[model samples]
Target chain A: MKRRRRFHIQPKHLFLILLAICVLLIASTSYNTFMTHSIQGGFSTVLLPFQKGMNRLGGLVYGKIGSIKELYGVMEENQKLQEEIGELRRENTRYQLQLKELATYKELLKITDEYPDYDMVGAHIISKNSGNWFSTFKIDKGSRDGFSVGMNILADGGLAGIITSVEAHTSTVTSIIDDGRSVAAMAASSGAPCMVTGNRLLLQEGKLDVTHIDKDDDIDLSYKIVTSNTSSEYLPGLLIGYISDIDKDTNNLTKTGKLVPAVNFSRLDTVMVITTLKRTEG
Target chain B: MRKPVFYACVIAAAFLLQNNLFAAIPLIQTTPNILLVVTFVTAFIAGPKDGMLVGFFSGLLLDAFFGGSVGFYAMIYMAIGYVNGFCGNYFYRDFVTAPVLLSVLSDLAFGILVYFFGFLLRGRLAFMDYFISIIIPEVVYTALITCVVYKPLLKLEERALESSKRSAKRFV
Candidate 1:
């Protein structure tokens, strides 16, 4: 008779197997292979309904609590806003006159408008990433809603982020405040180019790093910064933020500064996604 | 089989709370890592095998939801679970200090691992700033939440184990 052998499984073997599996998953996901996409898509589709229900329930509960808290401060806030509105109305009249003059100038120069009207869809934020390391969040709109990767998201009347991933019913957005993200921006007045980079540490102060500005650039504090025309992904002329401070770099060739982002990232609820992709020349 | 199902449900619930309810609460500056707490509690009660399994699945859930790469969290959490399981010999159902302490350390480990992979690997060498700002606050928050979370999870694990043992005895 042939000798019978039995297979034995140990904890060491299990650990090695798990390690291998994790490595494989990391590799596959990094490459963004079809298998990884399908798996993520499948899981997202299954979880979408439950997540939506949870989101609504959480919103209702939080809304009740927030309203109660707001009751205490509403009167004061209303008075302050009334004064602000009066000031803004005066400012608006002056801006209207300036705009008319600018329009006349544009007509004389025969210059085309830089800002294009974009087709957009509004989306509600469903949930945010659990950890503080990344400022990515999921929104209710997805591929079904005509959202695709790299579509610019606008919130609070400025550029918020770009769509990074999309499933059937939900999509993920990496906000401008996230680490490692950079936007090509320019001073609205002088058109001097700079790079606005995200830093989580600076996020506590509601600022991002504005760097790579030429030493001779005339950009100064409180200057309005908008997206540059040369940006590969973002449509040009969307508002980014204002320059808060500028400093001479040690290298003397470039200057660095800080910017206050236009969007209030802490309370992003609803955002508009520009559905048009930036046209690229081949 | 029943035990696995129970743990899976618990992990799923923690995942939802971490991403949704806790995240929405404006009172807290940073949301606690409840899934990490669950992993630590599981590893503290159960042996390395169960700990590793729970950690792997929970980490995978996080990866599926938000991770750019699928297995970064999975590997870190699995190692945490396996290491914490070695402390099971000192575990008692009523005691809370060990679990609380271990959770803090594990959270720190998680933060450091994230910093290493997410920042350092990308040539962002600002470790001191990250440690001071992001890592410390998260560790403190997760530890405080652990005090509230540990007892309930221990009770669930005990009940599941007792039922499993009873079923096994019946088979014999």
Candidate 2:
């Protein structure tokens, strides 16, 4: 009788394959928090030049499109701007005096003075997650530039996001608006503490949800919200947003409202990463 | 026409374009998943093994760029590519339906997995809201991109395959 022919993957190969997958899964889960920084950095190093070239090309295309759109509106915009410029110049002098006075007061009070060495590195927003807009974005600066996880990112306006992952020459920023965790915030007026959280349902309307406000707190609509002193990750007093549309919870204990994020996440081009690590001395 | 080198170049270009060029185009609210489309196209043109290989590398590229974990996207893309590759046998070269349908299904899978892992596990229980708002629109957008990109990629694959055959004949 002829020997029976068999076609099957050996058990040893199957075990090896499963083992490899398990190892990869474990490694990836820890990648952001702990392990694999060097490996991730290496990948970023390879991708840096390509990313830079592509970013330049993207900017060119965007500029052309913008210029074409501007052509039709230029005349009307010019007229409006010309009329406003004269009035704005007068207001600017008055504002400059007030700003100088406020700066003197801030210096006297030692506000934001704790971190005297606070410095920032500027980076261009190179890429965004296509599926989720600003949920995660790549910056041109990274670990090589002294960036690390948990550092705060700010845009022209205010607190843009936080650095969650760092590579060699690139880092990924998860903006405060994306649906994930919440940030501890305090009302600039009443000192009432709250939580600013990303909500997808609310984000379509260009807003985020603020929770944990005391029901009886006289929180005014449009009151400025800033990072709370109690916040472990974010530094105190960074502007978060302005609160609006407060509603009491069914339990009548806490209030929830909407906040208009300070950073216009869609138009973000340049961002500055606050390299100062939150003082862990407490 | 060197298969490995060609595939590598194509995947890298696709990754860059997907993240930067197409991402900047605000014509659509949600950017189309060009890398995902490329992975499926490779599977549709090549067989399962090649599809899996391409899918793994493309997913790895994505993960390397922005993924929270290194293997999350790679595993998902590999699974999608392998399954799509089985559909290759029934694929007619000129037909557009296969890619469109495959894109929709694969995107749906991606959305479910992402939501499950990223949100639900993290105690964000608003499944219906995310599914309708983000997941559905993304699936539609990705499918639309498939309609435009399918033809060129198919042509490229045909040319590459023919050239490789000629080279192989010469070698023999």
Best by lDDT: 1
lDDT of 1 by residue, A199-238 (tens): 8889889899999999999899999999999898898988
Docking class of 1: medium
Positional deviation of residue A13's Cα in model 2 after best superposition, in angstroms: 8.8
Question: B4-31 in candidate 1: lDDT tens per residue?
Answer: 8999899888888888877766566688
Residue-wise C-alpha lDDT for candidate 2, range A11-93, written one tens digit per residue: 33433464477357647567444555655677778877887888788878988898888897997799899999999998999
Best by DockQ: 1
Model 2, stretches more than 4 Å misplaced? A1-23, A26-28, A31-34, A73-117, B26-28, B166-172
Give the CA lDDT, 0 to 100, for residue B47 in model 1.
78
lDDT of 2: 0.80
